[model samples]
Target: MSDTLEILLTNDDGIDSVGIRAIHDALVEHANANVTVVAPASDQSACGRSISHGGEIGLVDHELGYAVEGTPADCVVAGLAELGPDPDLVVAGCNRGANLGEYVLGRSGTISAAVEAAFFDVPAIATSMYVPVDETPLREIDLSTDDFREARRVTTYLAEYALDAGVFDHAAYLNVNVPTPGKRPAPIEITRPSKRYEMDAEATDGSVTLHDRVWESMDPETIPDPDGTDRRAVAEGRISISPLTAPHSTNHHETLTELAETYHDRVATADD
Candidate 1:
């Protein structure tokens, strides 16, 4: 716990992206916390912690600071282990889109970066903005960069209050999403990741089309998610913050263990 916040900033969107720049700017406004950005030189969305094998990682001098040539997780790994002092907190986004629901999380590089940090016993946050379809350009979304004021609002507030207040003590990391303000009736709710998405993938003549059905694209009137779920809260135009823990083991049943032991002993004795 340094006296001041030392932050390691990163994103799935490449270092030159607008979203990362906006976030870095907002964090720099804090006179106390120092922000150092070490992120992928190129966009690695949905790559999900996949590291390059012996690839070149060099310093990229940006207007903000140095950017690395690797995945989002690579940036965090390099920053903590090599580049800067271990950050007080790792913030992974202000991503181009919401990373709500279990399915989305498993596929999102932004969330994966935060998850990687949690493995090191460091608290992290993954933030995103919801942009309705057709409103954004295919080029930029392809480039994977955007900054909504509401997304920044939630991220700034969380960054300021979350650490010192010990909110992260309970959760390994937070996954936050700001609903597009265009959606009517905004309300913020503490929520859980919804695990409701089905994949419809098909292969055509030398091509593949993977359709991702996100409920955020649907009208709030049609979503079947219960209250307090991350998807539901965002659909309602609220900033959704989900407290998440990475990779945990469930307790094994004593009776089952005992039975397994007994069976194993009998089999061993019989073999002897």
Candidate 2:
């Protein structure tokens, strides 16, 4: 509506996280956008679209923006409905870890925030960086704003130009994944979410342990994701952008329709 871009920025990580701060600064300083942050006060990673239903969500004013005591989805709702200005765009993340597969679409709070915006008919972008798992566990790795430099650049560029480019005309949101900044700048790739699903569950000693084995093989050579997939692009040191729709797409199933038509008749015949 306004000539100046108004952006609602949020993330799965807390308001004080480096990734969120990096993108927030980039949007204001580089993109010259009016950015309002309504992010979780604490890390809410992997909390997909969960909201505080029929409950008052607490909000605290921060120097950057408002810190919400709820999920990423709550942040978007609060921002759009009450907390901040009506945004031209909603941005989530510069997330610490990559959300690259179709399976992750329903689990990532970072992407969920963007999806929440889409439900409100607002264009959105969700950005994340690929953190490689090495000898040290991912939890032990300390990342700074420098780690998100490339993500910040790409996100800012998209925020500034994508609207004019009509990128969101078809897509509800863009899921963007970037590799950790390299000596050379990573190339951009338009990709689809990888369909690879490698979840494993082990049951022992009356306890079940669930594991997503995909993280163990992020090497370009060993990565099982095919070309043109988000995971492959990020694994190969490239930025991956997947344009996505919010609502679940459906196809007419003639077989299911026929089955439904016969359901009552079949049950009566069986009873007889």
Strongest candidate by TM-score: 2
The parts of candidate 2 lying over 4 Å away from their true place are none
List clashing residue pairs in candidate 1. none
lDDT per model vs. reference: 0.79, 0.93
Cα error of candidate 1 at position 211, Å: 1.2
TM-score of each: 0.86, 0.97
Error of 2 at 46 (Å): 0.5
Q: Residues 236-270, candidate 2, lDDT per residue (tens digit)?
A: 88999999998888999999999999999999999
User: How well does model 2 score by local distance difference test?
Assistant: 0.93
Worst 10 residues of 1 by lDDT: 138-147
Q: What would the per-residue lDDT of candidate 1 be over residues 105-170, giving only the tens digit for each residue?
A: 877889989988988888998988776666665335643223356666667777888888999889
By summed lDDT, the worst window of 10 consecutive residues in model 2 runs over 132-141
Which model scores highest in lDDT?
A: 2
